[model samples]
Target: MTHTIAVAPQATKHPGPLGRRPAPQSVAELLLRAEALEGFTVAQLAAALKLELPLHNRRAKGFVGGLVEQALGADPKARTQPDFPALGVELKTIPIRPDGTPLESTFCCAIAMGRADRASWEASVLRRRLDHVLFVAHLAVKDTPLAARRFARPVLWRPTPPQWQLLQQDWEDLMGKIGAGQSGHLAANVGEILQVRPKAAHRQVRTWGHGPDGPQAVHPLAFYLRARFTRSILRQQG
Candidate 1:
């Protein structure tokens, strides 16, 4: 049976239970706070925090991520840098299917296809965003309501040498393609650890990219960490 989770009356005023200031001082403190949310459903957390749960799954894609940020006392500002700029850590919520595999790739960030040609791995935004990450994995069983999913223990991760190399290779390859004006030919299978895929909500959504004649309209794309790569991380953490 379907259920309509109730919204808190003060949700609008008190967006998160934890107020804005005094963010977590360290990674230990952050994980400790995240651990407190391990057993609660999204609805339960929202209700406790006097927040409103999303009415639909598609519209709520970022709901869980927001909840994590709130629970950890993260800064409210949506910056291009890490969620905890002070700690140099990015927060990522990963959706995992019943079989323990990620439901989909983890989106890194929207990239400017036209500017990618001039980007370098050492100076890439994607590299900086992923330099340190706090991953919160939640169960995404088929047919389950958004409010009912359960979270696993969150892990703070930094890639090992091999993992870093794989990611670097992928980044260089994809950037090379963009530089060559071949972004139109890129696909999901282009990289082992990372992939550049379309990010727009609709097919007609377009972004600027290099063309034979100059800048041209092209599909907006974002960098994503492949599920296999994340699965390997989970195994290592275990």
Candidate 2:
């Protein structure tokens, strides 16, 4: 499938929601721009931006996120820092079922299994990726065409104190297990609010990890926020 980059229009010094700069200068500006996309359909957005929609399901995985970033003037390319690095905010595209429940776990980032000994909850990539988020929920029904999904209003959020504590505990516990040479025994059900799962494009992809015999080949794993956690965020927003 072919993917095209959409260029946002230029903004005046005092721009309205639709005419805002491609890269918003502040959090308020980002939200205002995002809110402007509240009810647009995938096809409508594609037409407005003159972009092509993916023909296959698998190829459309990041399509909505890319669309939102482009609409709000974000870099189409992935970055080590937040999507809006200057404002320290990450943009997440969440697919929701008809009942308004999240369709899947939120992917955090690739875990550094071999570097667990040097990793800390406060300094971990997962924490940094989640510091602040702008969640854009899209309606996704199974077996439906990509262009039919509709966008919901965006919600900005940060973890509450209790939520952060729970996340920190899970991270510490999992890192401890990795440090103890038990990565092979780690399972998706290991954490309460977070889980570690294989993250590569396929099972054949592997990375380094600690093992009984020292470093061993293991499937690359990434941290994911549990659906329950995300559901709570949505419920709280409502």
Candidate 3:
């Protein structure tokens, strides 16, 4: 039997019973709001906010992220910066399997391809994104409908000394490639925990990147945290 949660109109996009939550003033207020949603299933969330879930995976992937932004009062436009600029915090929704392990890699932020060569670890985009993150772990097993998935406890993660070391090391290594104009040769297997992959829906999309021959067309690379790293964070929190 397929156990699914009862949801409101699946086609609706307007604010529903819960309407929309106000922007949290402080980190305390934000966590209070997040705590209220700790155990709620996706259906309950969508039903309350009257959000529509896309039928397709590509569209659904972004819709779920938007749903979190709406619920958390973060502006999607400022994704280049942190989700909540006021609090200097970023909100991330991690899909976890039964054992509380991440089902996939977590998207960190976009790469500054042009200036990556000289970008310092202290001012790197990855560093800023990881500075303070609100990680909302959701139950995301295969075959489970998006609406039926439940959200687990949210973890507020700040890197410790060792965690910082790991990220800095990866950043420096990846930066070396970009600096040397060898970004064209970067593979998914380059970094230990932080890796870069093209951020496009198809092969046709391309972006200008520094190449050995000067400037060349290449896939737009973005930062991603390996599942193992995120799993470690959750385990440590527990």
- Deviation in Å, model 3, residue 169 alpha carbon: 1.0
Q: Against the true structure, whose TM-score is highest?
A: 3
Query: Local error of candidate 3 at 209, Å?
Result: 1.7
Better of 2 and 3 by TM-score: 3
lDDT at position 5, candidate 1: 20
* TM-score list, all predictions: 0.87, 0.87, 0.88
Residue 6 error, candidate 3, Å: 22
lDDT of 3 by residue, 111-216 (tens): 8777776789988878988999888777777888887676677778899998889999999999889867887788888888999888887988777778887777
RMSD of each candidate relative to the true structure: 6.4, 7.2, 5.2
The segments of candidate 3 whose C-alpha lies over 4 angstroms from its true place after superposition are 1-16
Clashing residue pairs found in predicted model 1: none
**What is the overall TM-score of model 3 with all chains considered together?**
0.88
lDDT of each: 0.77, 0.77, 0.77
Name the runs in model 1 displaced over 4 angstroms: 1-22
TM-score of 1: 0.87
